[model samples]
Target: MTQTDRTDTAERPDPPESSESVATGGAAQAQSQFRRAWTRFRRNKLALASFVVLVALIILAVIAPLIAPYGFEEPDYEHTLAGPGTAGHLLGTDLLGRDLLSRLIYSLRTSFLVGFGAELAALIVAVVIGLIAGYRGGRAEQFLMAITDVMFAFPTYLFAVLMVAVLGRSVGAVILAIAIASWVNMARLTRAQTMTLMQRDFVEAARAMGAPGVTIAVRYVLPNAVGPLLVAVSFGIPAAITAEAGLALLGLGVQPPTPSLGGMIQDGISYVTSYPNMLVWPAVMLAVVLLAFTWLGDGIRDAFDTTGTRR
Candidate 1:
């Protein structure tokens, strides 16, 4: 009952309540969390409305080329600044006589394009640098954090404008500018979350179990950190959009006759007193985008809170 009994016990498989079970149970718990969150989210009237509005805007942007009645570039001077419900143009024309509705559709697409592209670029850089900064610590952390500090010190709008100016006022430029400007925030967030998550017992357990550093960070630390990261991304999209618009407003974004929202506002501002509608529509659209994103972000934040159901 000594050596032989010890050997047999050691050879026995892990118990049913071991790590594998924990994984399975954790997955189920995650699913349950998602269901609960969704149930709560759906009950939020403002959030639901905002979600619907965002979906509709996305759909419109996607189908713009096919459904736009008139080419955004095509202009009818006779209809310039015409009030809504004109002969042919529903929303009227801009200073260049371009179709307002069509231009707006394109602008929405461009805004979303820049937002998503910038976030993607930032995400790539942030994930790598952030994980390294958090996991490696010491000099690596110091260097990376120092760089982030420098980025933070620079004015966000000015930095974006300068980058876009260097790159030129195109869609790619806008995306590149915002990405470069915005990545610091994401990197900081990632580093903080990673540092926190890396200290968890599960992460230590993974390390004890001989999991590689990258594996532990990617598989365990990152997944848990993704919730807040996702919230950051949700918030980041609107910020990017606003940045793009601001750049365009300064005549530093998409070239004229292209129907960018910022450009439209710029044009409409001159005639705001005479043609309030010109500024009105674009302003409303921008407001809607801002509000929708805010609500969605709030809803997501509430869902992921884990503290309570109220948002």
Candidate 2:
């Protein structure tokens, strides 16, 4: 066939009578990529373990209320400060006689909520900004990168603290603050990936096929460029969780009558001299959860590296 025929073929919409071969091939490619990625990820036993633990943590957080022996706010004055296993309060009680286990579970839920919610917001903003900046290059790219640079210059936690403090320390506010603070990394990641992918022959082919700018960016460039952003998302979650925990620890997060891992830890610190378990469990959980997120992110990065270095 002639070049014109090939270009027409590339740009032509499939007729209603067309077979499913094209769709099937695309599905097969996607499935193959996923299968390969999963294989690479599984080869890193620690990352696989981390992913499993992370899922378990999310499940545990979801079921916390149903499984807890008592309400998070229910006071057991008689059993106040009770050590582990007292009256089936497995993790013990805090100074207020609240079951530590119940509070811990609920607090965990809050932390994870902040993590996932904030990361989602950040990713949305990042993807949009990155797509515009990278695909549109020249003046648009320069302007967008300038803004991203300004955002990066500010300390992320400090920005979050300022935002949450101004907006009041609610869950939504915290998520918003973290999003504003953390989207820079994702934006930069996506932009770099887009720039790299835009130079490839497939992108040039799409451009030469009379594709509109937005269509090419969205359908061809964005999807292909998301690999780096996927890794960024994995890392961003932990950053968000830590940011929320820090705010809570400093007494700027979820107020009293509400349980959050950081707030609970702050409360536990007062009694840490006498009751170490109060401070220990949440701290351990935070560490383990963050470690899991980091491991999983690393695994995903390696899996999608495209360098064929993954074993």
Candidate 3:
């Protein structure tokens, strides 16, 4: 065939396409990606099981108030620290005869709140710093990176403790502390990704067309950078949760009356030698939740990675 015929054939639309068909095609592509990811994720049976356990734990947390026979705080001084499987006290009682299971459920809720809050804050800071640093590449980049470097220099727990000390010990303060220290890593990650995306053909084309800096950054750079950022966000949640737990362990987080996984674990520390189940069960749940998030992040990272397909 002549070159003209070949070009025309390549450009031709499919025969008799309707809006329904276009919608159907788009849905099919989405389903295909979903199925591919499911297939890959299921291949790791341990990860799949961990994800299921995490989901169940979250559901239990949401329904804890409804399910508990006794209130989390309604103390039964008459039956303090009753052994496991005691009358109406499922999973046993705390030092004050408060339901261990109920406390655990509430703790999960608080931990997740801290995790999500910190993750979102980190995402925003990272995107802004990364975009400006990557695109501008001069004084702004150096200054922001210098700040990020200072954050990175301290140990995670040490940074968190200092922030809480300065900011005082509210839930928001704890979350803010973790977010401030945590976001620098994400900023560096996003900045590296933005640098790569800025060099791509589409970015060059946008620049050639005289697109505004904000427009090009948002439209061209950000979309390309989103997958890695999402993966980072997923992984970052576990880190944030761990940070909150560490702060609570140090008696500087979540405060009284607001149960967090860390706080629950801290409450059990005194009784750990006597009733180790109190400490053991909470630690296990925290580990499982963190591992599930890490696995999910890994799966997402692998799914979005074109290099996997190339291999």
Candidate 4:
């Protein structure tokens, strides 16, 4: 070979990496991001405690049927309104003689159902609308955002009340109502994230390569935007749970014998002076759920933050 040819060959860079290597690298990067976020989350004592508590509560709710001393509706008419530690009723019995502890366990299951179900529904609607509005960016964006703005004007609780009233009171109705009322925040956050991601070089490259809008959105934009979206969802869940509780308090949530936290609170209100434990137990459980979710959400948001600011 010519001396000049040998020199040019040495100057050339290594060939582009194979597709398998690229995929593996992407996976590793994602794993690293997860580890960093987890590390940050673990460092926050309140958040770590909340995670453990939340997981334990979920487990308790799941196995409630096995552990509960009595059926939620099964009454011990002999011990009606009995205080805590009465015979088989550890936490006492309601006016109907139903075990308070058993009802509380079932109520927790109901709350979790509403929280996760509503959040899942809200995520679907929010992500779809946000992606279309931000990625398309035209009259479509203007129209969709206009609707979102109108939704924002209504008070969330009032809107949820109206929906539940219209749909009729039930678990399914409560889930749908809370989802409709709560999706606006997620949609707005998602839109902002998608808009920012669209300006990225990778997105531009995908577009230049003739990728369809859907392909670019799913393959490039959505994955990049997921971190912020998850943070939004973590925050959104507690709101959904609270909304359900409020609706139940107002007699528009899960119906009688269903044993929702709010319903228990409503029932307990009548006996507040006579037997405060009835009111206190459900209220305490609700407070724990709310605080756990709020603190955990704060931790997740902080962990995902790239700004390196500790709260």
TM-score of each: 0.88, 0.87, 0.82, 0.91
Off by over 4 Å in 3: 1-45, 309-311
Candidate 4 per-residue lDDT, tens place, 53-131, comes to 9999999999999999889999999999999899878899999999999999999999999999999999999999999
For model 3, residues 1-311, the per-residue Cα lDDT tens digits are 99999999999987864444443443354456556766776777666776787788778877878875766677778778888788777778888778777778888888988998988998899899989999989999999999889878978778889999999888899889989888888899889988987776666666666678998788667766776787788789998999898888898988877778888889889989998767877888898899899877777767666667621
User: CA lDDT of 279 in candidate 2?
Assistant: 95
Clash statistics: count for each candidate: 0, 0, 0, 0
RMSD of 2: 6.1
lDDT, residue 269, model 1: 90
Ten-residue segment with the worst summed lDDT in candidate 1?
18-27
lDDT of 1 by residue, 88-126 (tens): 888877676777888889889888888889998999899
Clashing pairs in 1: none
Alpha carbon deviation, residue 205, candidate 3 (Å) = 2.0
- Candidates 1 and 2: which is better by lDDT? 2
Please report, in order, the local distance difference test score of every candidate based on alpha carbons: 0.83, 0.84, 0.81, 0.88
Q: Model 2, 1-311: lDDT tens per residue? A: 99999999999987752223433333345456767777788889988999999999899999998987789999999988999999878999998899998998888899999999999999999989998998888999999999999999999889988998899887888888888999998899888888887786656666666668897677767766666778889998998888888898888887677788888888889989899989998898889989999999999999887787764
lDDT of 4: 0.88
